[model samples]
Target: MPTQIVNIKDQLFENIFDHAPNGVAIVGLDFRWVKVNQSLMDLLGYSEEEFYAMTFPDITHKDDVAADMELLGQLLNGAINRYQIEKRYFHKTGKVIWGLLSVSFERSPIDGAPLYFISQIVDITRQKEMIGQMNAITNIANIQNEKLKNFAHIATHDIRTHLGNLGVISGFMEEELEVLKNNENFLMLKEALSQLESTIDNLNEVRKSDFSTEERMTSLNLKDFVDSAIYNINAIARHEQCKLINEVDGTFNVMAVAVYLDSVILNLLTNAIKYSSKERQSYVHLRSLESEDYIILEVHDNGMGIDMEVHQAELFQFKKTFHNRADARGIGLFLTKNHVESMGGKITVESRVDVGTTFRVFLRKA
Candidate 1:
């Protein structure tokens, strides 16, 4: 009895196992559970009796059992002093749990025989989940950054090109003004200057657009915005002799920024007019449909449709246009796509050469 008391004292002092908050366990050299603490039972939702009745292999996750057994063999064979690793375990209720496990060998005083193994298991599920979420967010931010970089390059190049065009025309006007002062042809030169000014204004507006602002959202009536767009572009539509057809439901609403939505709709409407087939009567269809997830708008025109093979990839790129229409500056579709995506929406096109084109806009329902 005295010897047994000394043994218990030595085990308690040398083990230093009981005070740890993580589960502490002891397994015999034969890989069976010899002792387990209160923390271990609590972690696995098992009684002490239930834990003792099973071997370590039975509780370990099946995928981890073989690897853990190999680590145990290294401990038993005196190849390692301690082993630390992350592994999964099967709880009493059959849930898989992640744990950080550290194990060391134990030796008996009698003849220095290998007695058992001591293991400490720290639960790390919450920390692991947090790491996964952080990685996902980081990936999304990287993709957004790449897209923003592309947008900056496009805006710079396009604005610079328009500025260059204005400079060339301004130079011509300077020479013409000196040669033919107040001549009737000067009115044509003045008109060109006015158009250049309009182009510069459009460029500045696009540059100043801040699509990232969360405060820009409000519930907007689709028909009202479309009407506003139509009125804004009345001159251009009238010139093209385009008939505007509206099939939108009166009460359709969407969560969007008012100015950006107005710009998007106006651009689409004008594009439908601009690309209308010269041989046929120009007609544009502004249609809307809705479902639980999205509000769908289609801008359809009987026009000289796009060639998908060569132009599909560049369709939404700045300064890219398949048609050589006189008014095409190539920024409208690019800006439209960005505006749609900025507000948690998407835009796509369906077209074939000479088969007409459909621009589909999908906005989230408010």
Candidate 2:
């Protein structure tokens, strides 16, 4: 009865080892296969007889052999009891496949003599391929972003020169025809030119605030920045009959580029006041909220809110306007969004037509 029980235990061990899902093998110190399960044979596309005649180095990718040997040497010298690595193996079909190889050794219990190695391999070919694809996409996007920066720089320089010459010519015309200065059409043209110049200046500011890999960020007090924005925009807020309220906490600081942060805050505040509702008491409120990774600054307003259902898609697009106001050049939100994102932040909006709008800017917590 004792002998039968021992046999049953041995059979159970063999069954469990052989039916394991991942490749499993017992290898000698020479790295030669001494025993292998069906999974191991199927993984490397080899038969039991073939595997026995071949050493692990025979199937290992040539480039990976050196690292594999180095780690194996550590294990052999008792420097490590086990090791794991991502390695490539050449299949019988002459193709390379990726595997996560984990190896440890068995030793004689009485004398502590190294016996053989137990290697388990799990296929990671699909995951490696997916990582490669994502890397390629990231590279492409980086290249495109750099190109956009260069284009904006060049365009701003050239357009500014042309506008300067046009401005000079317009001045000459106005002086030569003094009566024309008072004409409504002439005034309109001059106002349009002035607006164009302002638009270009905004674009240049946006270009200047573009983030670069080497640019260092500074820690800024959120409340201080909000206060500065409110001070500068006070005249406009008063002119528009909109109240400005600052609720950002003094304790909260954010990592940001100074010019970029200023532009983002000012734009949101100005927009809120500019679009304030005429039917009710209008106010623009600024506040901040905290998260583990980000400081969310919010600008809320009771304004002539956007019809989000209709303009959501075009909200942040350049030259896309949702309002009929003469000052609505449609680039404020566009520039604001660019500035926020360039600083490794993000912007989102929530609005209801004729009700109110809230703009949230998420910045890295300092």
Candidate 3:
């Protein structure tokens, strides 16, 4: 009766494990597969015999090996009970497989030594590919925008010089041709000069409205700035059920224009709340990292992610709106990028639709 009960329980476990929705596998301490379910086999395009003979390393991407190995080492050292990472693997046909790998450490029942790894892999290949395409699109747009700025500078300078010359000639005509002062022709010239002056004023406004390539930078306490920004944006976050968190270390500061820093943080935080996911409670997290030469500020959000394939190019274009939100003028990111680059910094974005978005700004450390 004892034997029969044990067999029945094993059968029940097998049934549940086989029909599981996700790919599940167990690898022994020898780095050989001890067990793998059907879903894992289908996901990897390998048969039971093939997978059983292979080790996990045979399928992992080369670039991800060190990180994965490090995590495994931590688990074995008892530094962590489990580790999770979004990593890449090689498919059977030599294609890339992006998987969110969740690994838990197990120990031998007899000797209490490290035994095996239980891995649950969820395929995120599509999400990774979409982000890659979006990055390409954004790069092209940035290049074009740079060209447009150069063109504008040249065009504005030439137009301003021409207008100044026209004004001078009109003044000389009004003084020398006295009788013509009352004539419609003289009046028309006067009107033309007035219009030219107005045009130059408009051009100057445009120049001031965008970031100046030569804006002055100052040392800024990133933590203070972030705190102030969050304080100001709290009501909206509360209304949206969005929590804004600051995890920046207190020791680091950056070389940034103070006014622009305020605007960038506020605008990004607003967008984070504005496009929040309805499926869960939303969050906007701010964190910073320090390197030898750069301070990296990352603004992360769990929001209604962008359809990057369709909207990446126009994401930072002035007046280019992507979402149906009435307040999305599309100028915020444009100005944010302009201000960041103007202060000798760089910005990048990575996102997965319906998952989240992360904006990374790299600036010189002060």
- By TM-score, the best candidate is 2
TM-score on alpha carbons, each prediction: 0.45, 0.60, 0.54
Q: lDDT (0-100) at residue 76 of candidate 1?
A: 75
- Model 3 misplaced stretches (Cα beyond 4 Å): 1-13, 109-111, 208-366
Q: Is 1 or 3 the stronger prediction by lDDT?
A: 3
Candidate 1's residue-wise lDDT over 1-366, tens digit each? 599998999898656665667899988877788888778888888898888888888888788888888888887787888899888888889987789999997798877778889888999978988998999999999999879767866876787687678767767777866865556455455554554455446545555665554556778898887765665566677778888888887788988876578779988887788788888888888889997788988889888899988898999999997877676889999999998988789998998777688998998787
Each candidate's root-mean-square deviation in Å?
13.7, 7.7, 19.1
Candidate 3 lDDT tens digits, 114-170: 877888889888999999999999999999988977787788788888888888887
For every model in order, what is the number of clashing pairs?
A: 0, 0, 0
Candidate 2: tens digits of C-alpha lDDT, residues 194-278:
6557657756765777556126568988898787667666666777889888889999999987667877888898888888889
Sort the candidates on lDDT, descending order: 2, 3, 1
lDDT of 1: 0.80
| Error in Å for residue 350 of model 3 | 43
Please give the CA lDDT of all the candidate structures: 0.80, 0.87, 0.82
- Model 2 lowest lDDT segment of ten: 208-217
**How high a TM-score does candidate 2 get?**
0.60
Best-fitting candidate, scored by lDDT: 2
